[model samples]
Target chain A: MFRPCGLFDETYAKNIAIVRTRQHWILIIIGLFIFLTFPLYLSGRILHFINLLGITLIAVQGLNILTGFTGQISLGQSAFVCVGAYTSALLTVHLNFSFFLALPCAAIITAVIGTIFGAPAMRIKGFYLAMATLAAQFLIPWMVTNVRTDLTGGSQAMHVPAPSIGGFVFNDQQSIFYIIIPITCLSIFLIRNLTRSRVGLAFLAIRDNDLAAETMGINLTKYKLLAFFICSFYAGVAGSLWAHWMRAISPDQFNLMESVWYLGMIIVGGMGSVIGVVYGVLFIKVFDISIILIGPRLTSFLPPQLAQDTAAGLAPFTFGMIILVFLIFEPRGLAHRWEIIKGYFRLWPFKY
Target chain B: MLLFVQFLINGILVGGIYALIALSIVLIYKSTRVFNFAIGEMMAIGAFILYTFLATVKFSLWIALPMTVISTLIIGFFIERLALRPLIGQPILIAIMATIALSLIFKGIVFFAWGSPIICYPERILPGEATMVGKLFLSNELICTFLITISVFISMSLFFRFIKTGLFMRATAEGHDLAQASGINVERIFAVSWAIAAMIAAFGGIMLGIRFGIGIGTLPLVAIKAFPAVLFGGLESVLGAVIGGLIVGILESFVGGYIDPKFSEITPYIILLLILLFRPEGLFGLKRIERI
Candidate 1:
């Protein structure tokens, strides 16, 4: 909402626009140009990282809507992502459905499943609700592994066919970047608009005080379920993308730890803000990637007995330490810092 | 019928261990209101510490046991002071995530030190023989575990009932501001509660290690299993933890015995979902009334 000096909006449309000034549009266009053109210059490995980042961004955005906006904590998001991956994989492999068709189907089915698990949110709340969702985290994977071994390939990894559009295959990371980046942008746009709407206000209200929101006739059941539906839908999309991108799916890929990492991303990025999701995901992912890159080299410096264990342990140790440091010092997350930086520039020559 | 009795006895004894772990969780939650998801990691680290002293360092049982307890207690105290103390007034979710973060750190430490092998105590801490009680065989280790668990519960109850520190902890659990107004050092109580919880978790971990080798992989799962017990007893009720643990243990044993071995792994979570659906307050937890 901070505008630079000499910038004034005369029209309501101009005032409410997300990209308010010409400067804003220019920056966004430049950012989008860099994002879309990354594959041309960047290595295939980096492209793969971007694809994962974009997919995770979408998932974290959904989580932002649920936990960050609606104040419902979900520890089972990875399970929902698992469901989405499995659903899409099964649809394509078994029914011979197109990737496009399977993607939507995956998202919808995941939404339905998420709603079922979230139904307990109506009855329980806080830690109890977290426990209820935790059940889903365990139960869904168990079902996937044990229920239909023949169909799901049981605990063994299932091969996922690369997504294709009318004989145009997205077989590699570079090609998948085109599919992933655009969808990521679209989701960001949609969620940005969503948070500015009436429903977003209702979610904010409920999050602040559910009892008061109920008194204000916000219909806690409808909005809470809606948040879950949307959140899982995003997870489903991410999972479908992940399945195609990896060309293989396994239950281990989507575990409780993955869900916790997603939560960590949102917390670190700044909860309730769409941009925060991007910051959170990018920060955590980049940190993790750096750890992976640096771990081997760092381990060699240590004594041989401690080297292997330290190599395996450094990522988690640093990651956990960062999360704690952020929670203690910058609890509002990187988004708050971003806001402050932007505000400082906007209010140049005047202290506000 | 005789086989059923044997399973039942096994369930009760195993349940005692679960109860001890649940009590640790309840103790911290009661005082600090932070749900310690790191509890499993705490247990693992405790067991690993004991393993290090007994196996690697070659310390006698008498020295190693008390040393492990003291180390864990100190670890708990530092965790509260360093990691958790700053998060006191934060949201419940933030607090929970802090514990999760702590869990990750502890996990990394365990992995760094022990390297993921299933290690056992160097020597058998409890007798291996099983006592035959009219065709129902009871393992002496389990009986000892059950007795220790019961004594802990009894002492904990008495501590909360009569001791001055216990009284202060209870008062702090009720309300921090009220306790502070009455001249109770709420911060000290928080530290004490965490220290005691860590110690109890270490005890539970040792018992579990005695039964099953101390593995980084399966200890967290045991903590997850204890969650249903915590919920079943009500989050705050000490007695409820015991009853809930027993019920979960019995249910798991029966399900594992009757249906399939794998079903037992998920039974506690299933019960947790069911409990949340029907009785969110738990059987013994005080019903909370939300006010505007």
Candidate 2:
């Protein structure tokens, strides 16, 4: 807000006018060169990281639509993802379908399930609905494992054959990255369009005041269900992509903990924005990998028992701490920070 | 017939304790107007505190229980002060997330301290095998749980009805701005509310550890279990918690015992889905509050 409003830039002009430092063309060229090389660097060892990032970004975006845009709290995103993954995977594996066919199938199935799940939204809000969603998170997996053991593999993972686009199998990490990047770009575009449409305005209105929205003839039930359906559809697609990427689907792949991770992503990245979703997922996951990378080296400084004992526990502590600090200090999230920086650059010459 | 009766007895027994867990949540939400997502972890810490005081140092149940309650109260106070107080005027999302973060923190700290080992609390205080039956059977755990819960409820009622501080707390909860305007110390009430909520959570945790034989997994499980109870009862209603707990407990046991053995968690969730679909207000919830 301050960035676009030009408070900091104006303040800087008034206070710090004596000295100036500038970057040369070589520096800018070097920055652009590094920026362009990031993909080349990533294309070698861990192009699959992009696929995982894509899937997580989709999940986070779905959550942002529900929680940030519509003000509908959901803790059962895992359950919806499970629905999509299972549906899509089953289509490809059991029904002998193509990847494109299976993807839409997954989205439809998850969207239907999501609407049914969103029925809880009619009754509960804030925390109660959140807990209800939490129940869905655990229940869906348990049901997939135990109740539908004949279809789902229970504890064992169900195999998904590698997806092929036009007979060329995306059987490897590098090949999978192509699907992930394009789908992510498409998802971001679709969400952007949707948020600008009549549907999005209705969503915002219902989020602000459902009673007022309904009084204005907005049809709260319809829009609320639509939000759930759309949100779940994206999760389903993400899950399907994940199933294809991992070449398998299992109940453990989607859990209550991941649901919280998704929520945290939207919160950290910036709620209700595409960029926020990207930033949140990359930030948290990068921090996660950092712990894994640094854990062994840092813990060696302590006693062996303490070092050995903390291997599994440190990531959660770090994550929890991040959430607390962010909530306390920067509840609007990192996207707001991006806005501030962008605003600084865009309005440098003007006095407005 | 015997198995059915046995499941019924077990369900009722567990339901009593579940009701107790939901009460702690209800008490806090009633006063603070914040849903403590960390309730399960709070309960876990309570049980861990009791375990550490007893197992780590070799204390009796008589001494350990009070110490557990007090220590958990301190934890609760620290959390409210450190995390929640700063988020008071912010969006509800921040407060909820703060508890979740606190949940992760407390779980990590406990796991770090006690090493994630399952410690079965000795059934020292709660009696075993106190039963009387002719055509049917009874269990001591069921009887004992109900007795403690009822006593606690009665005590709380008395406190709210008679005690000056309790009344003050109620006034503050009803509307903090109004209460502040009326010369009540709303900040003190907030701290006290968190303390009371923590104490109740600790009580529920000890009882649950006793019931489940103690494990690190019990905290998250029990925390999740408390939801159906709270939802079944209105989130804001005490009596609703007990009724909801019993209903959810019986339904869950009935499903697990008879309907389908493999997928036990599905039944309560299905019930929740239906209740949400048809009667979103819950049995005791206020209907006017449903915005859509």
User: Residues B54-98, candidate 1, lDDT per residue (tens digit)?
Assistant: 888999888998999999999999999999999989888889889
lDDT by residue for model 1 over A80-187, one digit each (tens)?
A: 999999999999999999888999999999999999999998977777878888999999999999998899998999998998998899998888899988999999
Candidate 1 wrongly placed segments (more than 4 Å): A1-7, A303-305, A345-352
Question: What are the Cα lDDT values of the candidates?
Answer: 0.90, 0.78
Q: What TM-score goes with each of the models?
A: 0.98, 0.90
Candidate 1 whole-model C-alpha lDDT, 0 to 1: 0.90
* CAPRI category for model 2: medium
| Candidate 2 per-residue lDDT over residues B90-159, each given as its tens digit | 7667777888888888777766776666777654767567686755667676677777777777887888
**Every model: iRMSD:** 1.0, 2.6
Q: Candidate 1 clashing pairs?
A: none
Give the DockQ (C-alpha) for candidate 1: 0.79
